[model samples]
Target chain A: MNIPSKLIEDAVTEISRLPGIGKKTALRLALHLLKQNEVHTEALTLALTRMRQEVQYCKKCHNISDGEICQICASMRRDKTVICVVEDIRDVLAIENTNQYQGTYHVLGGVISPIQGIGPEELTIESLLERVSLSQEDEEEPIQEIILALSATMEGDTTSFYLAKRLKEKGIKVSTIARGIPVGGELEYTDEVTLGRSIMTRINYSTE
Target chain B: MNIPSKLIEDAVTEISRLPGIGKKTALRLALHLLKQNEVHTEALTLALTRMRQEVQYCKKCHNISDGEICQICASMRRDKTVICVVEDIRDVLAIENTNQYQGTYHVLGGVISPIQGIGPEELTIESLLERVSLSQEDEEEPIQEIILALSATMEGDTTSFYLAKRLKEKGIKVSTIARGIPVGGELEYTDEVTLGRSIMTRINYSTE
Candidate 1:
């Protein structure tokens, strides 16, 4: 495009660097910003810069926080005995939205992906182990279980398998979230892998 | 979503305000920025703020520019007697990409859309008339033609119609870009309106 102004081109280039945004979308966004009030643009810039500069990660759970430890890990009401392991902060947010789980979370940051050169060591796996061992040594209500709540992908499975092996040696029970046909899903439209897994893991029907 | 950090939530809210972006996509983008280098985030923020704070518009044609007059309007080689009226700077960029036109441009800023509460008074129509009248009084090469290069939408047609009526009173030729099947397009799937218009506006074939 024959951009008339250097500033517009610069802004477009910077915006297009974002993951899903392309040059045309970036141009549209830049033009939109130009047409809007300066206060709106300033607010967006301030929020992005401030978040990047001031954001902190929880020392215990590795989740995003405003201080050394996150609110979830610091809350006394949360069940410290059970740790729901997740791949990133988004997972933490997703699970928290359900309001079903009462346990604390251990954010691994990412799962084990060989193609991306990310392994167990690259994640917060070591810290998780240390947290478990330290809690056990303290003799306080020892951690009873670790829930592997990672994604249903190869990387997630590999990470879960490695952590289960290590946690078993430490005498801690490890569990995984159930995988089956999603609620409201039609079996005919379901992929074979998921349908097969759902049937294989089907539980006995019972009534009180 | 149960966002853990206020900073993350703030950034997501701000980013999602852009056109076409949703809350989930904003969250993803915000987290992506969190994981990236501080330099990348800083560059994005700086560019947006700088563009909003320092960008200027051309006084003659209202095109985005770094100076009082835009580069195209300031260039002496461009045809001064012909003006292509467009809706916005993006239209100017689109036409410039074609590299077929050497005339100048007049950015109307927007089209007439009563549904959106936008009218000709909201655009730069008055200034366009003033420019033409001023050129005519100066006895210089007066504007010989005004090409209506707005979009094919109803609002664009309304704005063009309004401008054409006014320009005709000034005795200047008014024209619009052709409406027909696009170049290299197949007729089998072409829309009936465009195909019919193409046939009705067909020109005589001649060879020298």
Candidate 2:
């Protein structure tokens, strides 16, 4: 893009490395930082650096934390026996925002993607198993259910299948989130696969 | 959106400060950085900080530069007597990319916008006038023309009009880029204001 300065070009190159940001957008962002006060730029850089260097992974769930354990893992109000497994930290935040699930979360860090050269070993699958086994050994409020709340993708399914097999041997219940058309989705626009799955797994209409 | 970690939330807040980025996208980006190798995040932060702190503005034209003078302003091949004035650095980059304009540039930093509390004093207008006067005093390659290449907005027009009035006294030609339907733009979909202006400023057609 014929950047005028080496500094701006260097900044743009690094910013464009991020997911979803293109070269043009990177240039815009870099120019924005240039226009802003130096303190603002320093603050942004400091925050990102601290987050990268200081942010810890919950040994039990692998969720991002400021300390040894995540807030959710340390909270007494949450259902420690029920763990919702997710592929990414963003997924954990998404579920937390819904406020429907009161259980703890186990961030898989990533799903099993063979095409991306990612295997089960590369993820936090072993930590999850260790968490469950540790709880069982303690015999105090042992993990009763593990909810596979991963995405509706091939990688998600493969990871869930693999985890379910292992968790079943440990005598713990392993289940998956339901797949259906979204609540506000129209029947006409619904994809055939989702519609078919909804029909096959339809629940009986009984008011409690 | 119920971020899991204070460090993550801080990073997300800073990242979301960028234009066009929202809270959700910020969280996603933060999580992405967390998953990536630490070196990548450090590189991004270092580049941005260095760019913000080290980038210099050309004293002659106010364009971003690594040294005292920008590459365009310092190059002897560029027509220094003919200057194209623009509102921002991105505009300078845009004109440079066009490969049509051989003249040097004068970056006004921003257009006059009363609503935003930005006036002539807030821009590089005084410096531009000073530059023209300095060249006139030298009596060598006096500026023959000053092109107002600002955006076709009310503020851009106001700034151009203000500059034109003062520049006319110096006996130098003042011109603005033509405002009309964009290249390949459909006449049917063109707005009335632009169509009317185009018709009023229409020139004789001839193969030059």
What are the per-residue Cα lDDT tens digits for candidate 1 across B53-138?
A: 99999999999999999999999999999999999998998999999999999999899999999988999999999988888887
Clashing pairs in 2: none
Model 2 chain A: which ten-residue window has the lowest total lDDT?
A199-208
Which regions of candidate 1 fall more than 4 Å away from where they truly are? A204-208, B138-140, B184-208
- Give the CAPRI rating of model 2: high
lDDT of 2 at B36: 91
Task: Give residue A186's error in model 1 in angstroms.
Answer: 2.5
Q: CA lDDT of each candidate?
A: 0.93, 0.91
Please, what are the lDDT tens digits per residue for candidate 2 over residues B95-198? Answer: 98889999999999999999999999999998989988998988778888999998899999999999999888888899999999999999999999999999
User: In candidate 2, what are the lDDT values of residues A1-208, reduced to their tens digit?
Assistant: 8898999999999999999999999999998888888998999999999999998888778888777888898999999999999988888878988889999999887889999999989988888899899999987789999999988888888999999999999999998999999999999999999999999988788952
Docking class of 1: high
